[model samples]
Target: MNLTAESVAEALVVNVDEERIDAAVAIQFKDRMRDLTAGAGGRIILDLGRVIFVDSSGLGAIVSVMKFLAPAHRLELAGLTPNVGRVFHLTRMDSVFPIHADVAAALHGAGHDL
Candidate 1:
């Protein structure tokens, strides 16, 4: 899992550099995300611009992260490749979380004046 993190406006922008987010690496991804937002004080903008696929485990991991964030933090997804986006839509998971076109859009939607 090649991922990078940066602060974008009021959100933590996480760029996933992998082509697929599968069960093999979902746990690690989740852990890293949790660490990235540990002391951060805003929503998380996960930029899945490079991710071309996502399986049920990957989706479940994401949901778990969202659940973990709870009232303390928020999670937003952005730049979902067509295939990955389709999975979310197919499973109706897209409606379970907030999705954005890009980090900037996610930030703006989160009410950050960036």
Candidate 2:
């Protein structure tokens, strides 16, 4: 799980730098999310452009990360490939999180600092 966290406007953009977010990396993903999200305020945009596949475990990990944010913050997903998009749709997670076509779109006008 190669995760990079950067501040973009009102969001903390965390890009998943690997090709897959399956069972093998699910734990790593969750743990890294915890470390990266420390004291992070406002919106979180998870850039999944490089991620091509996600198993059930991966989905659960993502959902858990969202839950950890809770009412004070929000988690948005961006740069979903076709297969990843389909999985989100099939799992009805598309309704749960705001999905953007790409990182640029996700950060558009979301102005903030730190």
Candidate 3:
């Protein structure tokens, strides 16, 4: 798994390079995200453009990250591939979190608060 973090506009853009976000990679993904958001004091935009697949464990990891952020930090998802989008739709997680079609949209929706 590979993750890269960069400051984009007012949000932190986390680009995931993993092919799958499943049980095998959940822990690492969660830990990396935690570190990326640490003291950043801004909304996080997880760019899932490179993530081709996601499973229950992956979704759980993402949910855990959001929970960790709580009412303080904000986390949003963007550029979900079709397969991952299907997962989110199947799990109804699309309603639970904000999903954007691209990084620009996600950052804009975050309102430059980051």
Clash number by candidate, in order: 0, 0, 0
> How big is the positional error of residue 53 in model 2, measured in Å on the Cα after superposition?
0.7
What lDDT, from 0 to 1, does candidate 1 have?
Answer: 0.81
Worst 10 residues of 1 by lDDT: 105-114
Tens digits of lDDT, candidate 3, 23-68: 9989998999888788886778888988898999999999999899
TM-score of 3: 0.91
Whole-model lDDT per candidate: 0.81, 0.86, 0.84
Clashing pairs in 2: none
Q: What lDDT tens digits, residue by residue, belong to model 2 across residues 17-113?
A: 9999989989999999999988998789999989999988999999999999887778888888999888888999888888888889877744221
For all predicted structures, in order, the TM-scores are 0.89, 0.92, 0.91
By lDDT, the better pick of 1 and 3 is 3
lDDT of 1 at 34: 82
